[model samples]
Target: MPFEVREFPEFSWSFSRHKTLLTCARKYGYEYYASHNGWLYEADETAKHAYRLKKLTNVPLAFGQIVHELAEKAVRLFLKHGYVMTEAELIEEGRSMLNRAYLDSRDRKQLWMQKPARYKMLYDMYYKGELNRLEAEDYRGRLHVVFANLLNSRSFQDITTRPLSMQFQQAEEFRFMTVDGVKIFVVMDLLYRDLDAGKWVIVDWKTGKEAENDRSQLALYAYYIMQKYKARVEEIEIRNEYVLSGVNRTYQLMEEDIGLMLEKMKQSIHIMLRYQLDMISNEPVEMDEFPRTEYRQRCETCNHKEICLAQ
Candidate 1:
């Protein structure tokens, strides 16, 4: 395969899209292709009803979003100004935010949350200190730890002092030109130049647990920068700060990795193009082509289980 690193491509390949396709083609079809039944006004009654549930998230996903927002705020403050919120402050604010989400979800739980109403119930139980013995103990216990881990990290400390020539902080999805005419979309949490190392650095703060797919995520960011920028960057260093464990995994990219990453992108892009075309033509993808997971246990926790009938 001829690897051509050029200017950024138009909006196309996103991490979520690829992940969805890999996880379940039917889910991907329901999401991206069908726009999660987003036609709304034009959508049939069934589609309109299904679209609402498509976006409903469970506790873990909601909790992760909350953490990401908090971390973004804390990190932005330290970067723009030399201020770090104390651990206590972080915990207090986290609890407060959790409370707010609970109230909001609870008020509207009838419309969205199912019987037992986990969304509203989660906050209600946590305040009552029930998670201490429940299966949710891990999330509650590690809740405030991410603040300390992120604030104390070497790179984070340096971010407070060392100014970069250029930086993109959790900016909107980056869209650019691709040689193959396959557009790519990715939201970079952070990308900046390191004057000392002369390497562009990308940081993606991960929560909860680390997954093997993280490696490719960082690699894709580097691939985007390399293709987008005209400057002759020696290398791009990517960092994954798994806040829950205070683990910082860094990867430096050279020609070897970039070449390999491009190959991977090619495969993903090809599938994406076909899937997109199928959707655009209003062609129904064969259900067997995107079968449910063999692991029935996974469906127990999947948000789409009800809609997909995975079991």
Candidate 2:
């Protein structure tokens, strides 16, 4: 007798999910389908382990998350109170977050949800008495430098200077709608409506280098907003701010571009469906179904490399 495979749905498409599928289908299958069991502390041991592995984050991702969270909070505070932190204050806030998280993970080993990179910095700063240790974790203070760059960057400066009365928003704003049976979700880091220019600005902050995916993500945001607001593609402006490098790229969807991105979304949905059918209903999914990535270099940074074994 065999157990039943879970029924994979077509209606859930997130940028993160799309990214995984684009990166490596095998990894996508592992993350979304194989390792997607719900919390069942009383369930089988194997199930518990799978859930834990699904939730783990690596050092680089952890660092980015920290930066994003603190940045979001700091900006949220500023949007509400017109208060901005100085560089030294930002560094202190970052260190405090790192130190608290480090102590939490250190004391509770199994409950540790953070990566070792953060803990290493905190450990050196306190126990090892190394005052200059943030550099070691983020490599020459890259993390702090990037954070400062964001605080001082023109893009962010605009955010701070804007009056609280004008509608400035954060990622807590999201919209979901079904497009030909596929559910699409979009969240923006900051959204500001400029009545004077008659434009809707959708801003996304990036702590990493520019990539084609970044552009694709902006396209998706534009498409979704066009659908949600029934606004002209020309009225929607998408801004991608790479804070680390102080580079800002803005994109707007033309009428033709909207059609193209929608088609792209449909194509991605079908690709995911093709992989889903192979993985869920069948055992020993054919290698060709969720084909390993041709670019082996990407495997080095992938979290599911061990499971994928993609050369």
Candidate 3:
């Protein structure tokens, strides 16, 4: 296999930027530099909580990945067997696949995490001399077979046969090039294609429910696809599976919609960057505490609530 390396100058846009700017640009600016300056997560408890989640690549975000895997597998199985599965069956298979995948892929990603020593020490402790390299391979291969079997089961008909074909292609670091000379980094969830239409689409799988109007976060994905593939972004979908009624709703992307999002992201970067430059020129800066916001019903189950309430 061959891989190419590309570089985007020292800049990027993230969804957090869009939200932060919407809430408070001054806060965005101070936090951006404070974050990169290496003192933000350490001094601020909320920042620390956010940082930990972002760094969690193992089974942390596994639920959605597992769901997608099972759905896709079900589609394949349905294609082969001409059978459709209930949503409940698909969800159950998804959980099983997730556990298997976590155990199997743990070692492959062990080397790549920003923190390797953490897992390395854990692996060292768990390994037994009796099980050699061959045993490890057997363990991984068996799990892969199990996961594939679950994915190819019959219940995933709807998502599989749908006109939209999607795959998750992500890296801890994303290299982006823009007309403004902005190089961006992101952790992406899904990249989609309408094979029949030959158009590019981006989908982000959300475990929680979202409003139909809530699209600012996914707009960054549209921006990246437009720039990276040089193809007109036909649609941007945010699949929120964790809805109040447990239904998934998709929003279509219009040119104007993405344009506004980019404008906001750009403004956010500008605001944050300007403040960061000023702060660098100053003596020193301390990270701000996570500002308190109203706790919505949706936020009750959010992983960040503990830290939010603590603040």
Report the lDDT tens digits of candidate 1 across residue range 141-235.
66778778877765676576565544544556445546476666667766677777777888888876889879887777777787777544356
In model 3, the runs with Cα more than 4 Å from the true position are 1-11, 20-159, 162-179, 233-246, 278-311
Top lDDT model: 2
TM-score of each: 0.78, 0.78, 0.48
Pick the winner on TM-score between candidates 2 and 3: 2
Candidate 2 lDDT, 1-311, residue by residue in tens: 69443433233788888888888876676667555443443545434443444554544554566677777877888877878877777767766766555555446444432332223323222233343344436632666787778887655777776654355644555577788866788877777776666778887888888887687777778777777778787888888878778887887667777677788888888776675434434333443466777888987655555445633
User: How far out, in Å, is residue 168 in model 1?
Assistant: 5.6
What do the candidate models score in CA lDDT, each in turn?
Answer: 0.63, 0.65, 0.45
lDDT of 3 by residue, 1-311 (tens): 59422221124556555565455443443334333322232345444334333333323234444555554555455555757666556545655654454444445443323332233211221222122345334433333333343334221222366624534243333555453655555445445555554545444444434555346666666667777767665644443333113344455677898788777767766754553323324322233433333435633433333334454
TM-score of candidate 3 relative to the true fold: 0.48
Candidate 1: worst 10 consecutive residues by lDDT?
3-12
TM-score-sorted candidate list, best first: 1, 2, 3
Q: Clash pairs of candidate 1?
A: 8-176, 8-177, 9-176, 9-177, 9-178, 10-176, 12-183, 12-184, 13-184, 13-185
